[model samples]
Target: MYSSLRSLADDTFCLRLQRAARVWRKVSDEELSNLNLSEATTTPLWLINKLGEGLRQRTLAEHMGLEGQSLVRLLDQLESAGLVVRRDDPSDRRAKALYLTDAGRKLAEQAELVVRKIRARLLDGVPAEHLAIVDGVFDKIITAAID
Candidate 1:
């Protein structure tokens, strides 16, 4: 039985959103594992690749919505893994700039393809117009939550 929009939004929307996120992550992790990557592990590499090289560490943390120290730990692990490196920023010696190694760039590209495959599978039959509308709603919700 269909319910009122207000009721559904108030009671079910958040749950559905959370479930969708969980499912997306689960599928993404499983697929990425084929390349010896997991969502948590691939995220920083992918983000750096997407945003371009020499991104400031503080900027990366802000983009990731992570605290600086928390991001530092991840960066340490990535550096040790030889996927990323931190260089002293030319403009600010105390600030670190992040860059992906050749291996990291290659892995990031592969992870990107795998993510696209998972996204395509999940949105196989979704109408573009409906997706646009949903995206608009999501944008507003995100803005409201952040504000």
Candidate 2:
């Protein structure tokens, strides 16, 4: 059985994590809320910034680990938000390519800063040497679940 102190310690850690997440989200949400960008667009926006240079939507979807209608829905929302625009692939009329708009690019830049600030705040109290251990444990858990 867990002792009261042990339980209290676990609860305190969980509370801190929850509060950190909330703070991180607040920074993002406050920064982006007026821009009409949804939180879901964050991943797709990053993907576009990384690989949308000349890739097709289908490839982007696969890269993002999304499939079929779900990807379509995300793409639709992004398109509707004017953050991303889809155009027919000149190489293949059947395929479409994606690109970020000027506004999207600008917003993404601001979002990046917000994300960095959140990271800074979260890691402020953490020692650099312990980061590797934290990363290692997270990677182990993720790999174990995926594998």
RMSD of each: 2.7, 4.2
lDDT of 1 by residue, 1-147 (tens): 457788877768889988998998899889998988888778899999999899999999877778898899888888888999999999999999999999999999999999998989999999999999989988898778779
Decoy 2 TM-score against native: 0.65
Off by over 4 Å in 2: 1-27, 89-95
How does candidate 1 fare on TM-score? Answer: 0.87
Clashes (backbone N, CA, C under 3 Å), per candidate, total 0, 0
Local distance difference test values of all predictions, in order: 0.89, 0.76
TM-score per model over all chains: 0.87, 0.65
- Candidate 2 differs from the real structure by a C-alpha RMSD in angstroms, to one decimal, of 4.2
Candidate 2, 108-127: lDDT as tens digits: 77766666776787689899
Q: How many Å off is the CA of 90 in candidate 1?
A: 1.3
